[model samples]
Target: MIRAADIQDGRLRGDEPRRIDPRVHEANRRSRLETGDVVVVLVGRVGEAALVEAEFHHWNASRTVAVIRTREPDEAAWLNLWLGSPAVRAWCERQATASTLQRTLSVTALRKLPVPIPPAGLRAHLLRAMRLLEEKAATNARITECAMQLSDAHFAREASDGTPWPERPLASLVHITAGTAPRPRPDHDGAMSEPGTAFVAPADILQSTSPHLYATERRLPRGKEGRVCAPGSLLVASREDGVRAVMNHVPAAIGRNVLALEPESVSDAHWLLHELRSRSAEMAATAQGSAGRELSRKAFAATAVSWPPQEVREQFARLAGRLRERARIAENESERLRELRGRLLDGFLSGTFPKGPLPDDQGVQPEGGLALSGPQGIS
Candidate 1:
């Protein structure tokens, strides 16, 4: 039999049958699930289903609803596909009881749901396609992991000493510049539409992996020469919040809270970026002001930073470039696959596609896994 506890442990990850807890389970202490069982959510946004792939035993369920066990085991995957379809999702949405906290589905409502049974061959093809997508996702995850490892190795090698390297004042290495917002005027339309410029505010600079500028409503076409940021220039946020924000990857027109740094002698933009990220917390803490924290250009220019040799800096940059490229590729692929999955679900459940019949036998039993509880607060 299926049990609510099995679903809680993620045993129904893919095409697996699931057992949801029944109110009667509380008193009997007996599992309510069986092999090839499917758990259908009744309350709180219905139409979510889980197929039971392995046998397990447990009790208890709160917001969850009814359990369905098919006579055939092989048909579980096809059932899962049907359940995840947009048509089914829409049906569930209609049945949901709207409340202030959430939408709920009742167990009785789930049993009467209708599903179309598709041709076996078509169902098999869809399952194969899903498997391929899963494989691609796994591959993308591996690529991202490798890229992270490469970055870690490079950084570890450069910062081995646990202390700042022999260095120079930041002012000596680069020219620091700032940008301004034009005073708001009555006649001037607030929309910025002209080309050849992108404006970046302190909010844009914060939480970016590389320097980037998104389009803004305000623009200054005439003041294009105020602060030009090229690919290798280091852009930092000058506001107290800017000190903690990292530049997203892209050239942006500077906002009032940002500072643009153009390297004077050697090309060590990557090194500088890394150093700034490492020091951001400290810098933000030391920022001066009562109402809003601000980082003065003069104070920042006066700070000293230890620099590694030119060769080391260049090597790190090259390695980082390769890793970042791979990361970008993986990220793009992941997004595409996710979109594909969504579309596939839409087609599969709408009765537009067919699926195979259920199997005659049950699947294997699962091993005991780790237990996860509710969130814990820090002491």
Candidate 2:
């Protein structure tokens, strides 16, 4: 089974290949993936999906996956982003069938889902904006990778030196806390949650490969839930033994199965987050429980972390901080661009975008050989 975790890194990352029976591969000719197809999970985690690249066209998809073939390349790009949007995800949740085992979506239902397809002229503007925003995000990802490499190199150098750094139990420097237990689910027609105050879950923290949060789905009225996590506190997943950590950019009501690390002494929160990433193996080893792997407060507080001299730790933090700050700026810029793109898309698809047809001479040609012109002239 190709579970959601396989591509939870925000893309299909594995390079391993598997053999398939020719008979099984040919059985679903109609659904066979082609280059640039967008594959979505049809069963558990229905909205979890990714844009398939040319290299994966030869590979077959499991039945849990659904393939979306767009009429135009631009449309495929639009669909990929749209499918990941909060609006679309909410719709999927409402339509999904839930059982004791898991939730699943049907192809027929997905096909019938309404989408506001824009006219050619406005679509061209949308595609232009989409390309620019996506490029910016890709740039930030590259920068983040570089920052991670630098951090790893520093740790490697420290490890090479003789005499390990003095270690201290995590409780000595930081307080370990878990989130408020989730209340019972509201009746289908009743509202159990509200927006504005973010209610963060394990999956939300895991979405970012870095030690920071970019997005989430759960939210509540301000202060509705206990264990309110302020910006800069580190968070780790406790549900199903998910082993990832991140720092919040805003105050959020912590959800069940999430642990928050609050700095109480000299240990810097940012440095602590990176250190936690380095000791993930030890954290995983302390995972407790059976039905769902739970890391108890006792286990969390007992985690031993290296404590280097204050001056050395501060120096390292200063160097690493510069790289992280630069990457953070790029990430923030890209996030803002994505939000703007979503708004523009919503307007264009709804026929509310301030534009009508433009003169032939004023038309702008997109890279795809299509010209898009309007009252706004593709602004």
Candidate 3:
């Protein structure tokens, strides 16, 4: 079943979705997904949506997901893109009813969402551009995944080779510093690029696919620079799901829920990242609670970890660093593509881009010749 947690970074994570029996699937026929259906999260991370591609067809969604079917198949992509806009996202946040634990978006709010349609030609142009950029980003993600897998393989081989790596307390090899709580600021919401240090939060770490992070959901004010961790520091967070870690590529202020692990040497940082990732489940056991899990500093610090000699670690670091750098480059390129996408969408919606013929690559004529109709509302 596709739960709210399955909707991640504007895409559906089908890796480990819960499955239901055939009887259950047939009973809840309305939840069955058809190709081109858009599933939006109605609980946590409200409004996050993903298009139901051919592979996911016939899959049943969980109660937390709202299935949105466009009148026309082609409209599905356009509607999905519209739902990702800042205005729509903010609207979802405002409309969501907050409970003691989390916020929920009712079907009434989802049905009332305003979807502004651009001119026919402009809409066609925007869809083509969005597809091209999204495709590239997807390709980059694959490249990064492969690179990370290769690095993992290398670590496995090195750790298992003849010599026995000593079991040492985590605190002995690295300094574990807790993050500072963020001060209230009503001005900023959503991802911000304002002048300040990138604030690393649990969401940022959880959503990332790459081992390195260059930006985050929020930023810290200037004078708060002292709270920022060095560029190579590994940021860690724990939840009921598991433990996740990402090395910061830039100096970043760590949120209260995050823990910053700084190794004395750069080479050690590389080894530490993979070590922690490999032990995610093991480390998660040390977390304090079942709900809203928090890693126990005392437990975590006291935990024993594999500690290889300096020479062996440095050797592995050199090889792993090369692979990671390739992934980093792809991630950087993807970031640029995303920025360009936002600009293109903004320009087309604002009528900044003339309703003229676009470059061949950017323009894919829509199947229907009809001009885009009035504002659309979801059901």
Candidate 4:
């Protein structure tokens, strides 16, 4: 059965249903999804919506999700896009009620969502354009996935099958240090305020597109830059699981429970990153502590890491680098397509989209032509 996480960014995305027990799902056949049907999340973290593309046609959803079948099947795509729009999201939030820690949209409230029904012919251009862009973005995502898989395979092959190389202590390759957390200052309104300096925590680096240091929600006031990690340094989390390593591409101050490593060999930074990622599971196994897994400076320094020959390192670097670069580019294009879809919603719903053979100013028109079919997944 479908769960909230299976519905990603306005698209139903799971290789298989979350619950595939034929006994349970078959009993709820009335709610079984069909192609072009839309699923809107109703309980906890509400307002997330997705279209049931053909791939998920045989699936059924949990009660936490509500399915809607539009009057005109072709308009289902538009509804999905609209549900993901900022206006719709805001409206859903206002309509939601809090129960304990979970916030949800009631069936009654969800049913009343305002839907603008554009002339069927008028939507053809916008729908076709979106479908074409989705296909392009999906193709990019698939290629990126393939490239990353190939890179991982080659890395594993070289590590286990290639000629053996000497192992080296991590301490020999990099200098590691801990970060400090600055206390927040209280404002006149009695709320704690951030220091202007971009103070980072383990959580911020978790979703970074590139392995680079990006600005995060945490910050220190102007003066405390003491525990700073400059660009090219590696920021590692103290904990064993989740996002463990991020290359601080920009100069940023780090908070407590994090370690910053500066590689002795500058050019080896990216290669080191790949090696660490490949060995993430191993690193977790060796971490210290029963209460909460923590990686200490001493433990980290003592850890034995592969020191493959220069040629082997170079080969891995080239392969991983190309894959990462391609993935980054593909992800960026996907973001752009999302932006274009949002623009279409703003224009079409607001009656601003050009009526004739699409205007050059809009930059998105079906004139280039399209064959609408399915949803897309991003990297």
Candidate 5:
């Protein structure tokens, strides 16, 4: 089933959604999603929306997600675009009923959402402009996905190669530092802002589409830059789903739920990252708690980890680091494309766009062209 976390970054995450037997719900069932349906989060993180594509045509959504069946594909697409705007998100937040646990958006409030209807021609033009930016962003996402897949493949091949590698306890090779929660922000507004160290929570790691993180949804206050992991340090955390890890490109304040894994030798950063990534399932199996959501430091430290020869480690790092760097470049480009897309949408909806035909694909390119050439090594 699609959960609030599944709809992120204006799109439905590709991770498999929970499914039910075909006998329980058919394609014609009201609960089943249609191709053009728009799914909106009804509980926490209200207003987060995603368009149901052909891949999930007959899939079922949980009660936490509300399905809006539009008259046609265009209408559904239009609604999805509008729902992502800042104004609509703020309006959703305002309409939602607050509780000590979480906020809930009632169906009545969703029905009252203000929708603007423009002429067919104008709507088509707006959609075309938005579609162009979206396609570019999707392409960038694929580029990063390919780069990461290649890196993982390389590591897998090297690890399985008939080379002897000693297995050692994780604590012997890395210094484990447990993260502490930062002091609550004085403003009391739980929104992400700039000019502070990136505060990483477990959700940040689980929700990230890429293995590298440049920012997070929360930031520590100026004086509260608690336990920080260096740029290349491996930040790991676990939940019921399993263990998740990411390399922070900037100095990040770690949340109590996160654990920063700093390698004893600086050069082992990439090697350690890939090693942990490849064995995420194994490490997750050692996690404590009934739901496997809690990873004990003592247990994690005692876990057995493979230790390859220096030359082998260097070889893997050299190859994997280059692939990771390429992935970072693609991810950065995708981020810029999202920003540009948001600006375009904001302008179009606010009537600030130019009074002529929308810009062509050629005119929408950011300062640098959207293409890459040489591969670079990760620092």
Candidate 6:
């Protein structure tokens, strides 16, 4: 068993692959892992795994299982697919034993888990599908990176102007509206009845993303009389926690901890949203109170905001709008791809159908080249 200190936190590193500790020499280490070994989280929230395509060092582990050296490198990829499969995830969940905080898988139980090894042709087909998915994901990443660069450029231009611009307190340009705590309703109909409306709390605001207004909790119809936000208004969470206390992509009615800023000019919507996102940290820092720091409407209104030249603001609005649109497109495509991958995993792991077959060609193609093949009946 490896120590938790030796295992790098995978969540922080994104997709970068690393290795287990190499310093510890053990003759009978039953499950020795190496470069390209797939590591799966088998014991806890099972099925989360990454391919160890590079070498590193570490030792701490509890719920994780290190895939030992397999007969083929491609088998590691196949294992990743299996581990990610919904069926296997559910199975892992059933096998888990819970402690006070989390459920975990035991090593003996993991070794006894069943796995399907498809025929060579079917295996090749599955790999081909995965390769295509990876290619599409890479393309999506490039587009996202480009959009981020564009945002950086826009901000860079704004930062270059040295002249001090006129400032206006936030209150001057917009109305500060606060959300009310409504009585709890047992059903959606009850919540949306007279004087109730859809409201967003601080947790509802996802910073740097498009507006997300869907709330799990609904307010009574009577409560919404003064809380309805216009379609393009800026909603910010005043409470400092999570993505709340930041600007969101969607316009939502304010909850108790959120403040809605209605810009004087509709044209300034994009600019204001971008500005709020950029200054979220500063705003949060200035919020009052020891615990549950809050940004009062008066305080928020008193906050000074630099007013750039009208033309500059408009230019920023245009650029920001385009960037947001691109991000939305990328986000939608990514969602679709993820759903499709999930469906593929479900089908592949259920043993209901044979794995898809690869094309006749076997050798690796040129880097960044595309390959096409006939589609199966499955959509």
TM-scores of the models, in the given order? 0.47, 0.74, 0.82, 0.64, 0.84, 0.56
Q: CA lDDT, every prediction?
A: 0.55, 0.64, 0.76, 0.67, 0.73, 0.54
Across residues 273-328, which tens digit of lDDT does each residue of candidate 3 receive?
A: 99888888778877776554576777878889878999988998998889988988
lDDT digits (tens) for residues 31-149 of candidate 4: 77788888887765478888887888867777778777765677677777668887777778778876533456776777677766555566676778778888887787677667766
Lowest summed lDDT across 10 adjacent residues in model 1 is found at 370-379
What tens digits encode model 1's per-residue C-alpha lDDT throughout 1-379?
2222223211243222333444455544322445555566554335666665443334333344455555455466666666666566677676666553335666555555665555555556668887788678768866876776667567766778576668788888888876564321212221234654555555445523333223332345655536556655676764433364333344556766567777753237767766776676666643567623455788788778888878888888888777778787886787688678768756554544334434521211221111112111011
Query: Which wins on TM-score, candidate 1 or candidate 4?
Result: 4
Residues 26-103, model 6: lDDT tens digits: 432444445655565543344456555444322223224534345566766776666666666667666766564335
The numbered model that scores best in TM-score is 5
State, as a TM-score between 0 and 1, how close model 6 is to the true structure.
0.56
- Misplaced by over 4 Å in model 2 are 5-33, 41-49, 58-65, 70-75, 81-90, 97-106, 116-125, 183-196, 238-242, 265-267, 289-292, 350-379
TM-score of 2: 0.74
Ranking by TM-score: 5, 3, 2, 4, 6, 1
The model with the greater TM-score, 4 or 6, is 4
Each candidate's clash count = 28, 0, 1, 4, 1, 27
Residue 244 error, candidate 2, Å:
1.6
**227-265, model 5: which lDDT tens digit per residue?**
678888888888765688888888888876678888865
Q: Considering lDDT, which of the candidate structures 4 and 6 is the better prediction for this target?
A: 4
Q: Candidate 4 at 168: error in angstroms? A: 4.9
TM-score for candidate 3, residues paired by index:
0.82
Candidates ranked by lDDT, best first?
Answer: 3, 5, 4, 2, 1, 6
Task: For model 4, name the residue pairs that clash.
Answer: 1-19, 195-220, 195-221, 213-249
Candidate 4 Cα deviation (angstroms), residue 186: 18
